[model samples]
Target: MTTDPKSDGGVTQSPNRPFGLPRWVIGVVPILLLGLVVGGFVATTPLAGVDGGEPLPDVSIDYTTLPNDDTIRLHVTNNAPEPVTISQVHVDDANWQFEMTGAGGDRTLEPLESATIEIPYSWMEEYDYSVTVIADNGATFSTTIVAANSSPGLTGQVVWTLTVIGFLIGIVPIALGIMWFPFMQTMSKKWLNAMLAFSAGVLGYLIFDGGFEAFETAQSVPSGYSGPLLVVLGISGAWLLLQAVMDWLTDDEGESRLSLAYSAALGIGLHNLAEGLAIGAAFATGRTSLGMFLIIGFMIHNVTEGPVIIAPLADGNRPSLVHFVAFGLLAGAPAILGGWIGVSTQSPLLNTLFLAIGVGALLQVVFDIGDIVRRTGSIRSAPNMMGFAIGLVFMYATGLFTL
Candidate 1:
């Protein structure tokens, strides 16, 4: 034993071989204790998505303040193929970094999903605030906003809004169609020819509207020409699909006319889908009033669409109730599906594709109607031309509402 004058001559505590423990074991005791401490820390540490820190991709970040609670929520919209990690959320810098160690506090977010991070109001200051998120792979996502103390109206209100705009748009026209076939049945051949031409005119207007929207949507992409190219391809694909159906089915008059009517319905269905998408997107983005207006506008347009769907069947043969219902479902149900998808994913390319398909179907339908009218030998008669003009005017006028 050794004594130290600083310790008032107390016995020194020194290592010796007198104890039972081996020197090698003593050498490793501190190391084992240190390893246990490190292991505990790692076990408790809340890592996002991966065990190791890594970057995440394809995430859209949005920040908004919760006025009632004075808390800020980070909304991360994940659109990647795989799950991603968002480890650290900080404001301004690490000085205002938040601890995200709570259960389900954004450990992992699945593909095409969303997660939220909440930061306390105490951390906010009266400067232009920026929130930065660091992923496990060191990918950083950041956004700037007015200070959290600002009035609530300045921030976006985030809500997952689902709408039935498509169904409302469809039902009006379908109801009108229920009265059409019987009412038109007793009319003379002159009226029938005129009505077919009118329906063709309605289709003519739709082609222009749908084509324009499709091209515009496409031009939003980096490659401006892609929009026009997609339009051409969509038209070609629609024509080809209809042609394939025609070749597979009958060439007989009744069956052929029925097929044509259904084809028109398919075209109109595609067009309505685009409209539904717009309505849904408006609502999804918190534009409730805009959605309502769109529904009203599209409803009027849809009412005219009913005539076009039934035009192919307007020949001498009166269609059964089953046929009317079939056309209605074929044309109208697609809008509802489109609305659902539109609200969930606002994909412009997909919308453009749908418009292009509608273009192809409607254009083909117009030609078929014209062919039928031509066969009647009154393609330019007063009734046909006057009805066509009236139909065209009606359709164009509907566009004036700016819905």
Candidate 2:
């Protein structure tokens, strides 16, 4: 008797089976279809709506800018569950006439919608101003601008200035730090291991530092976005993504010293990007002193990061000049882009997200370095322990200057 080749052990293949698709796809399709059906039903029905008592008027002043000496522009968002009408605006307790724009150029703002208010008032420099917005439902929201100055625009002069600042704080400092690579090569094996431990300590300190900054920045994000949750998601996503990439790059034999060095550079680079954003935001907000302080502090703080990148490769093959240069740029160039974006388009959510990602990257690097320290010797050993402690102390000392 002739038998069909498609039959397996007298069981015939089902004609309904997809020809080229995997079996998992076949299973997933039904789940997705069910989800879509349920989602459509919920969206079409009133089941998605929640009646959380009475609708309260809530609003947030996302940012304020001075377009000219006589103009005070406010970017406002409605965080209420119901639409809100901006009834009036007050500058320094005095009612001011303002022109509304955005959200259909009306005073009424739908839930989670944003609008801009332009008030033609003579705002003095080096002064503090309190701007308050009154809602139609008798709700009020206010924000204070300290030492008010013209917000930086995307003009050529401003861009050039930011570029110079970015180069000074980002590229120059990191390049100086990487200069330690040759010196690291001459250290003894024990000292090399200690340096690796130190790198971990530095990264450990940074993880906390970045995490704190991210959480702090998240507080400024709109309530609807759930800033704290965004930080959590950002950190988790970045950590898992980087961990996967690292795992894919490493072979069964294990992670190479060169790969570890590159990873350290990437982690430090992300941290520097956040620093750039902070500095840029400070400047954009007219906190020149704070910006300068951050510049100096980051320059010093980042110098220590160079050793972290090179310490892993010190005992192994010396990377060529191209690799060293690549490492420096990888660790520093993000600062330039970050500074520009932070100044030109200041978004608390974005800043918080980047900082969270940086924290995650640093966390991964810290563990990777810990593994190296373990292979070198017991991390609890005197030299390694001291190195780690010193790294934390040094970063803290440098960080104090920025604060």
Model 2 TM-score, all chains together: 0.85
What is candidate 1's local distance difference test score?
0.70
Candidate 2 lDDT, tens digit per residue, 5-40?
A: 877788777656644456778989999999999999
Clashes of each: 4, 0
lDDT for each candidate structure: 0.70, 0.82
Off by over 4 Å in 2: 1-53, 252-255, 290-295
Give the number of the best model, judged by lDDT.
2
lDDT, residue 230, model 1: 82
Model 1 TM-score, all chains together: 0.61
